[model samples]
Target chain A: MKRRDLIKGAGAGLLAAGTGIAAPAIAKGVKQWRMQMTWRANSPLLATGPQLVADYINKASNGRLELKLYAAGDLVSPFQVLDAVADGTLHMGHGYPAYWAGKLAAVQFFAPIPFGFTSQEQNAWFHYGGGQELADEVYGELGVKFLPSGNTSVQAAGWYNKELNSIESFKGLKIRSGGLGAKVLTEIGGVPVQMPLGEVPQGLQSGAIDGADFVGPFNDMAFGLHKVAKHYYWPGWMEPSAVLDCFINKEAWDSLDKDLQEIVKGANAMANQMVLSEFVTKNAQAVKIMKEEHKVDFRLLDPATLGHLGRVSQSVIDDVGQTDDLTRKVYASYRKFIDTVQPYSELSEMAFMNARAQLKS
Target chain B: MKRRDLIKGAGAGLLAAGTGIAAPAIAKGVKQWRMQMTWRANSPLLATGPQLVADYINKASNGRLELKLYAAGDLVSPFQVLDAVADGTLHMGHGYPAYWAGKLAAVQFFAPIPFGFTSQEQNAWFHYGGGQELADEVYGELGVKFLPSGNTSVQAAGWYNKELNSIESFKGLKIRSGGLGAKVLTEIGGVPVQMPLGEVPQGLQSGAIDGADFVGPFNDMAFGLHKVAKHYYWPGWMEPSAVLDCFINKEAWDSLDKDLQEIVKGANAMANQMVLSEFVTKNAQAVKIMKEEHKVDFRLLDPATLGHLGRVSQSVIDDVGQTDDLTRKVYASYRKFIDTVQPYSELSEMAFMNARAQLKS
Candidate 1:
């Protein structure tokens, strides 16, 4: 039978089941699915993103596809979301590709890289440039289908207990960083340690780490990083923009009808837009609260320090690009796209922003 | 008797009409819609945006709702789209709020303002920070439902025949500009003239204007602006980001089922994301092609010139804010949001972009 016939058959079944019920009629036999998210409970934007996606899909589909979400460690450990989705234990998983960086180095490029594409540039590359195709090739091999579901705008460098006035400050500094940032930090003479999000504040308090790089001000403030670290730095060169992905079991995705597939794609796109906008607004407000209430010192990475870090980052990118064939391909495509877009962005977004800074308003 | 009963009644009618047909089944009596767009036939991203929205809705709704698009002048003049939709002559219209700036001064704020929010920040404010609510208040009064459908990332300052080295150069300079940017330009020493997009290149060529501010490289290249002017300036501060909107007849929109309404919203959201990404990629490619193939002279407004323009922009904003009560409310809210967001943006987007510029990569 054709796909439409199958959908009609499902609808007929649903109509029979829904008869005599007071609940609103759905499209067809309600497909109940569970999604596991990597974000911890109450993780601000990260946690909110998955719920938003589920809500959009459920409402837009008129409850035809109901998606129930489980926070990190609710159903399974955060790290196991991908595995569960791949094994058909869960229909979908929401997490960053960088979470699986250990399983595949190329996956890191799919999330974020040091001195990489900002949120806008990254989305441009993913959707219009060849980033999505590369991601499909990588994820397809792992028996999963991936879609970029959310983004946190450029993250802050980190919250620091002491002033970082010069390049010398990075030497031997134990910073809680992750993904490609960790790699770049190590190359720049910093001791980069990857710790759980919940452990970062405690680590800083106990002097286990000098500073911790999380997301931007919204998530940063939620973790109360400003209370522990008096100085908040600028220009998060590492993971400039973090992308969240929704992974589905390949079999489960292929089984859906075309309309259902489009619904899923449309829902995810809305979630991506909404989540980023939420971050921008929330981060802005968070910065204000931090400044007024906690007396946080906003610091920019010195030009000289940034220059040195940039050089080291380039070296790190080059080393990673040499890892394997897929990694090389992904890196080459990313580098070319970024290089092509940078000049325009520098002249446009960069220039306008700088000009606005000089304004009295 | 109830909403579901009404829909079921419509489905029964469709079933009677669709008897023995091999075509795929739609939701019910398929609702056909006509969308008139303000963009010209060959307009680049602007024209493509409406088509993308229509395609998404048609496919996602399984043709239950089919949107037919008519380009500018195809059905009515470009500026008449909003009026057409408002009067139910068309179900929907795609245009920018700024087009109706003459009719309602406050409408311009919903589009792009001089030295206003960037695309990301604009989206943030519109979706999360009361922009949409204000827009509803402004547009709903006209019997239209508005949604942001597309965005062109920061436009170029304009195409100039002579280098703008100082604020003095702007004296007596007649540039083809529009909206709030034109207001700001007039305040600062230049003569800002409003003209159709088609007239800009010729105006610059025939010395009718000294320079013209159109969109960024992609659309600007399409207009062959480079052939008339050699100096391509940085930062289209006039419209840091231009937002395109879709206006639906309020009565027609309210008539849609909850699922169909969600579908329309989802389609427009996708279009917004897609259009912005397309601009980023295409604009970057256009810049590369222009530099290698056209040798356009890229210039940045000198710091002194930028500073002087920034000061004048503030005054213009102040004057515009005092126009009327509604305009005052819109301007006040816009200023408050921008102020609250500026510091975070300065430390995040601005700092990262500047730092990336100094990078070896």
Candidate 2:
């Protein structure tokens, strides 16, 4: 049956809830499902994650549930992962929800708020700390169900043509960035330009932007961003922990038999890990070459700039808190979870770094 | 100041004859080194990969290269990535050599090795894939360094207490899986499984694992395997995508001059992707609902076990020929690189899991 039919069948829940029925209707006789990925054909994580999921489902269902993954440009633009699935144009798709910050501001926080929780803590909040409920409330309104798809650790500050040492250096700097980090940069007097990944290189070269913050080394190098900028900075403050999502059309989601549902959850989890791991490997090597071999200047995004960015981020968060009920609820859950987890993490890494800095050489 | 000094200091390599010139030692005045992680602390990848590197160097350098993680473990694991270090270890550590299996491996492959490349081929073939000649080779071998940290994705066919149907029944056995299509299972016998997040409970309690496989989901699931298993399988043939490493001892790794080394290469290239990605997130979810979820009956082994786990896995390639040579070469590079990466990792995860898995899930 068509993917849309599966979603309609699951919609029985709406009617059941309205009628006060005890159970929702189950979509039966589903043969195959498709998931479109936002990454390119050869992206290690993008390619491998879906491949693993397809393999798992095919084996589990004994060949009944086939998952076909269409890479970016095959089914839709990389940026359209949310809409295609939410509108029931596709069964599922993989991407970072923060990409759709305009549609829902809270979506950005769910993925990565500047100086947000790390991957582990974020997962904790989502799975155990009440973050998922808040996310569902927001996504439910969007007609999609999102599962953590992957993570990209703390990212680099971005490629820069000039060194940045203080908060003043950031003022009026035209930069290519997106998601909530863009909002924070704007607050700090830097101009944030949002552009698709494919368009980044050209943006930097033509002077449409001074620099761009994309994923780390491998991806940046692959796009030849180094040729356009020399000073590469560290710590992607905007996306301290950029999280990706596996968006499934809610209607299509509710139709599967119980066992099938678990498979999807398990598959997404596996995909999340696989993709992240790959990014780390490729990015690390690329960064090494970019610096030592290629002569790229590597530096931190100056502590002053960092501090200012932090303050700006907080203000943006406060603004979001006052804008909508959904944002407020999610913000509260997010803030509570972050506060609880940060202490332990800070003690382990943050505290260690502070003390290490004082060590006598 | 050359990359070779970094490799020698890390003690990860044996310079080719006539290439043993000792470079000048550390000139002095090094600041703290920031290492990006592809793993979260709780995930197996995180447990075994980065933390070990950090702990080792913190003590060895006497606090010279004070390493700090930008994300993962706490900030980003599997998702938060993009290493910008110089050298190996955190400069490089943990990633999947097999991820480039597409560009690296010719066949339509993404998963590690179902009967394809061994850790040896996956690693060895990399040397032949022009990858070895590329910066990756020097980086993979003498320049950086790495090791095989953990292997959780070598998974199990999930837990179930019922008998599976004919191949057609395979069509109906809702399973949770990912990656390579279950073409082999379909070739043999069974259905496919794919579904959403909410229905796993009723599925498993109702006899889902009747044959479902999701890596070692038991670690993360709240339910115990005994609650749903009538059988437990082995050698996760489908996965074959095992993990290995690329790591450098911090002091030895960081000894090179500031400008010439990037820890992001070699060990980190492979480790970042494979090390934590495989087990980081999966472990937690494996046992999320063991007891509350279902009643499992542990099955010893399936009858077709030996049939599927055939001669090929151990010694199918008598010589591996050109293919085998390439595999051997890549594995050899991995072996040499891991020599440097493994020592510290062993003290961390091996010590913990060997004890922990015994205590609980």
User: What is the per-residue lDDT of model 2 for residues B1-361, given as tens digits with 9 covering 90 to 100?
Assistant: 4643553444333122212222323546544544545544444333555554554444333344465543343322432222222222234444443333333332213234443332322332343233334334333433443434434433444555554322243444556543333545544445556642234445666765355564354352533445445544433555534554443434445565432232223123323333433343344333333323543332323323433333332232223212544456544444333332222112211221122122222
User: Would you list the clashing residue pairs of candidate 1?
Assistant: none
lDDT of each: 0.84, 0.52
lDDT of 1 by residue, A1-361 (tens): 4844654454355335543112232555777776879987567888777988787788777777788777776655789888877776678889988888788878878867888899999999988998888988888877788888888888988988878988788889999988878888888789998798889999999999998888889878888888788789888888688889988888878887677788888888888899999999999999999889878888899999998888888888889887999889898999899989998899899999999888764
Rate residue B73 of model 2 by lDDT: 34
Candidate 1 chain A: minimum summed lDDT over ten consecutive residues — where? A18-27
Winner by lDDT: 1
lDDT of 1 by residue, B1-361 (tens): 4844654454355345542112232546688877878986647888878988888888888888888776776655788878767876678889887888787778878868778899999999988899999988788877798898989999988999877989888889999888888888887779988888888988999989998888889989988999999799988888898888998889889888888898899899889999999999999999999999998888889877888888888788889888999989899899999989888888888999999998745
> Looking at the true structure's interface, with contacts defined as alpha carbon pairs within 8 Å between chains A and B, what fraction does model 1 recover?
0.85
Residue A117, model 2: lDDT of: 67
Q: Model 2's DockQ?
A: 0.02
Scored on chain A only, each candidate's TM-score is 0.90, 0.86
